[model samples]
Target chain A: MRNLIDILDLTTSEIDELVAVANDIIESPQKYAHKCAGKKLATLFFEPSTRTRLSFEAAMYELGGNVLGFSEAQSSSSAKGESVADTVKVVGYYADIIAMRHPKEGAPLVASMNAGIPVINAGDGGHNHPTQTLTDLLTINREKGRFDNLTVGFCGDLKFGRTVHSLIGALSRYKNVKFVLISPKELTLPEYIIKEVIEKNNIEFVETTNLEEVMGQLDILYMTRVQRERFFNEQDYIRLKDSYILTPEKLENAKEDMCILHPLPRVNEIAVAVDNDKRAKYFEQAKNGKYIRMALILKLLEVE
Target chain B: MTISPIENGIVLDHITAGKGMELYKALGLAELDCLVAVINNAYSIKMPGGRKDIIKIDAEIELNLDIIGYFDPGITVNVIKNGVNTKLPKIDPPKEIKNLIKCKNPRCITSVEQELPHIFKLTDSENKVYRCIYCESKAK
Candidate 1:
């Protein structure tokens, strides 16, 4: 009956359990191959996405589940003006679970309310991406072997980056976690996030325009692309697009073990030259998304 | 400068000074043919600096108490019967608001569908922040 709409919907213990299950799936892929046998996953992607959609489809296939639904609104009855609430109610009858990615934030939330089955928000505008948060958690847990006492640096856009907001909210639950927010003045972390998550939670955090100065201090460098889609003004996006481009030269000051992550479909934010670097783990992070999603599908389906 | 009391109607007392007109508009007092007196700045001991807004409507219309409460907690609704305050209904703040305020998020489905109700869930009551249930956008 529960849906993964926001990262905060999952508690600390629940998140740990999910991470544990994800690790288990990674350890023994064959054991969970048929865990979701005969179940159906309706991926109602109203927006164009490659990684998130593929990850869900691939995860379901690995779990021995069937996949259904449209890739975009144009392909579905939505193009003819069928409402999301009505569409989900009908789809809920066909699918055991739904993984939806909509350009409009809260579309999945409306589905969760109307649908008979569990609804997963793959990505919702710039609001929240819980599954990505789960993927990030699994990646962090595997790479660092811990969440507590880590200096996490978030580079580039934080104001409109839902991943940064979700990850910061997730990590704030752990102990001794300090955040180093690196972005231009326009793209700096929102004051609401600073007030609600950082100040209210009493988590230590510092804001800066420089990423290199604090590179050595971080255990994890969470990189974010300046999202052109989230911005209302193309000029503003163009002006701030190259705010932080992670090159090998930028890694000179970073610690040897500091892992870098991006919810991919990355632009020029992270240089291709850094891909070979031992510290770069964004691709690995993307791969982890499938495993975590597999675990999430299992949890929501009660296949575990 | 006292407005005459109504014999059989409702009186909204102790609204936050500048917010009376907003509530008035939200409650749709425009279409009503009844005598609606809006006191934009009225003296009250309860409010800070002894100033508040009051609304007196000469009709027994059902009030959207939840919206009123969510809009401003200090507002009290008094029902007058036979020139006396016969009842004081408690306005419980609505935990979830549906279609009252539009989700301003351009990327919200509510913005596109146009037919979908603008739903908001009260996330933080103490800070009085309501988030759009659909897009998670904070209510302005």
Candidate 2:
């Protein structure tokens, strides 16, 4: 009956439990192969998101559950003018769970409210992507082996990056964690987030425009792309698109074990050469997306 | 000018000056068939400016105290019966407001779903911060 519309919906203890389950699934994939053999998952994607949609499908398939529903609004009843509530309510009749992504923020919340089955917000516009935050958390836990006392640096478009906001909100819950927000003045982290999440939690943080200068101090470098879709003006998007390119030269000043992470769909913000560095874990982060999703599916479905 | 007292109605006293019309609109008092008097800039020693607004409803209609409290908590509610004060209602900022104001965030689901009621939940009571339930956009 529970739904994940926001990252804050999951408590730190529950997150720890999910991470534990994810690690267990990684260690023993076959043990969970048929856990959901008789279940069905409906992915009602009102917007196109290949990676997230594929991850959810793969997670369900790996758990022996059937995947149904459309990949885009045009392919679904939504193209015919069906409301999200009616669509999900009808889908709930066939599916035991729903994972929805919509271009409009809070669309999954609407689905969750109306649907009889549990709903997972795969991605909701620029508002919230709890699963991505979960993926990032699993990656952080695996990389640093702990969530406490790590100095995390968020570089690039902090303003529109929901992942950065969600991750910062998630990480702020742990003790002794400090944040280094590195972004252009125009795209700095939103003031509301800084006030509500950072300052409210009494977490230490420093804002900087220079990523390289603070590179060595970070235990985790979370880089985000300046999304063209989030901007209204094409000229502004073009001006900020290449704001930070994580070249290997920049890694020279970073810690030997400093983890480099990006919520994929990168557009030149991260240089291709840096992918070879041992610090690069964005690909691994993508793989972790599936495992954590599998763990989330199991949890929400109440499967052992 | 003298405003007559209602026999069986509610009186909202000591509203911040100039907020009478806003409270009247928010409370939908214009739609009421009964007499509703809005007296603005009335002299008041308690108010910081020594002036206040008073609303007198000449009917025994249910009032949404939360809305009134949100508009001005200092305002006192007096229930009169037979032209004598019978009861006093307490007020506080509402925990959740529905359909009172529309969510201005264009990305909010409520924007596209015409049937969805615009809902805001009080996230920070001390700061008087109300955020849209759907998109978490702070209310202005």
Candidate 3:
């Protein structure tokens, strides 16, 4: 009955419950294999995201559910000029649950309005991505053993990073959590977000361009790519790209137990050399993404 | 410009000055066979320094409710008769809004599809930002 369109739609308790369920599944994977035996998950991805699409498929598989739907708009009825609402309505009859990703923002919202099944927004343009927020929450819970009282540092493209915006909204609900926003001036978090979410919540947060300066103080370092195309001035992007790159030298000042994360398909933003570090949790984070999704699938299917 | 009071027409109130013309254009009032009196700078003794703008549209055709809601909610429409202000009912925004205005995000569901209703939730009236419920895209 619930739709996972935005992070705000999920209450603090619901997220806590999801995190708990995700952790339970992680602890005992064999116990939840047939949780969704006859259910089907339709992933209607208008845009291509290999990592996200694959994770959803893998999640459904692990939950003993079948996965259907397209990875791109070219493969779906959307190519035939079908409205999102109509596509979802037809798909809802065929599937028990729907996970949709479209280049258009609010595509899932449109789908949810018409679809009878529970709708999950996989990714929608440059807008909010709630499932990734769930993954991040599960990752933080798994690694740190708690979500409260942590100094999480977000580096690179905060302005256009939907995951960053969604995660910040999720974490703002936690206790004693402070955000250290590290990004280039051009790719800083949008003012509307800062004004609406951060300032309104009275959450402790700071904006700084110097990642090295604050590297030692963070409990979680989330690094995202800074693409050249996102820059209006090519020269500025070329200058700042290498500086945001996470190397062993950058981790020199970082906390011994600090965890580093990236919502994968990572370009050179994170040096592969840091993969061996004891604190590198991006790979584990990626795996946990599948597990949390498995938990989500099982929970949503049981509602019907 | 000087204009006499409409004998039988609708008077719009609380319209931010200079917005009447924009609404006029948006409504395409000129094309219609109606007497559209635009009071750009009218003397309002109620206001400080007694200066305000009022618009009087005298027409047989009824105003488009959605068009009014889309343009300005502050605008109050009153049906006038025999130099007396008659019933002035507020235009409530549609319970289920259909496409008319556009979402701020061009890559939103409302924008890409012609069939889907272009929906926006009025957020801050002072800022004039409508938050697209689907995408959370803010537009002025």
Candidate 4:
């Protein structure tokens, strides 16, 4: 009866259970190697994404499950004008479970309605990415020891970053979490998020243009890319691109134990100089992505 | 007061007066050259406290005939042939519907530029929104 479409769908206890399962998998990888043996995971990436698609495939393979599905719409019946509903009806017959990534905002929810098996939304168009939020949760729990009473700084494109929105939605459920939002004025978090999620819950959060000023106070500095394409004026991007960068000089002011995380394929928002720093856990975060996905696949299929 | 009859027409009667105008606008009938006989505030009766407004539309647009049942099933349709009224029995919404309208979410797969059929189930007719049974996205 459960589908992993959005972070809010998972209760705090369920999140804790998933993180516990992921941690267990990390410790004893061999025991759960075949948790999904003889099962099929259909990765229906309607839009092309090399990173997320490959991660889902790797997760299924590591769980001893076979992966089948298209990486692009052109490669599937979508090219032949088949509808999402009919596609799910057909794909459900073949795969035990489905992991879908679509350019459309609500395609996965559509698929879930008709799919007899569970559906996982890998990513939807500026909508949500719940599994990534799970990965972040696991990483924070392991590193920081708890979700409550922590000050987390979110940097770069907070406006359109579905990950940030999902993470905030998930984190708001916890107790005493403070947010330090660092972004260009243009890329500030959307009002629906501010009114509907943040301020509505009375979670203490402050917006700032200066990243270094708040570096020392953060428990986790979540970095997101500031793409040139998201900018209307080139000069505005030029002025703000360096505003959110996490460099060695920047980390000098940051607490030595402060964790730096990024949903990968990151541009220069976090400088290469900071990669060697002990606090940089983005690559580790990427690896954790696979394990958490393994946990999600097993949980959704009710395999173990 | 009664208006002159057309040689052949369909009369939608007992529509809650103002609602006939809404149905007329929804069907874009104002620009048409067809004879539209709108009799508003022409009927009144004591129902405990006060009376109600009612109107009639005399035309043969079959789609509009179907729409009358959709908008307000209380209205009755009578096919008038040279002033002879032949009452057509009422119709109601189907118990089960496969698809209704395309979802409004731009990123919804239904909005994608493909020949795929867009389908929706009426979730809330009052709000005029449909819940895409696939995406679960509310489309207005």
**What is the lDDT for A130 in model 2?**
98
Q: What DockQ, between 0 and 1, does each candidate earn?
A: 0.80, 0.90, 0.78, 0.35
DockQ score for model 4, please? 0.35
Give all candidates' CA lDDT scores.
0.90, 0.92, 0.84, 0.81
Could you tell me the TM-score of candidate 2? 0.96
Candidate 3, superposed: residue stretches over 4 Å from native: B1-9, B25-35, B45-51, B58-100, B125-128
Candidate no. 1 TM-score: 0.91
Q: Chain A TM-score per model, please list them.
A: 0.95, 0.96, 0.97, 0.98
Q: What RMSD, rounded to one decimal, does every model reach?
A: 2.9, 1.7, 2.9, 7.0
Tens-digit lDDT string for candidate 2 (A1-304): 7888898999999999999999999999999999999899999888999889999999999999999988889999888878899999999999999999999888999999999999999999989999999999999999999999899999998998899999999999999999999987778999999999999999999999888899999999999876667677898877766657889888899999999999998878899999899999999999999999999999999898
How do all the candidates rank in terms of DockQ, highest first?
A: 2, 1, 3, 4
- Model 3, residue pairs in steric clash: B99-B118
Q: What TM value does model 3 have?
A: 0.90
Rank all candidate structures by their TM-score, best first, as comma-separated numbers.
2, 1, 3, 4
Better of 1 and 3 by TM-score: 1
Lowest lDDT 10-residue stretch of candidate 4 chain A = A191-200
* Model 4 regions lying over 4 Å from their true place: B1-104, B113-140
Question: Considering only the true interface residues, what is the Cα RMSD of candidate 4 after superposition?
Answer: 3.3
**TM-score preference between candidates 2 and 4, better one:** 2
Best by TM-score: 2
Residue-pair clashes per candidate, as listed? 1, 0, 1, 7
True contacts kept of each: 1.00, 0.90, 1.00, 0.71
> Which should have the higher DockQ, number 2 or number 4?
2
DockQ, computed on Cα atoms, for candidate 3: 0.78
Residues A17-41, candidate 4: write the lDDT tens digits.
Answer: 8888989989999998888999999
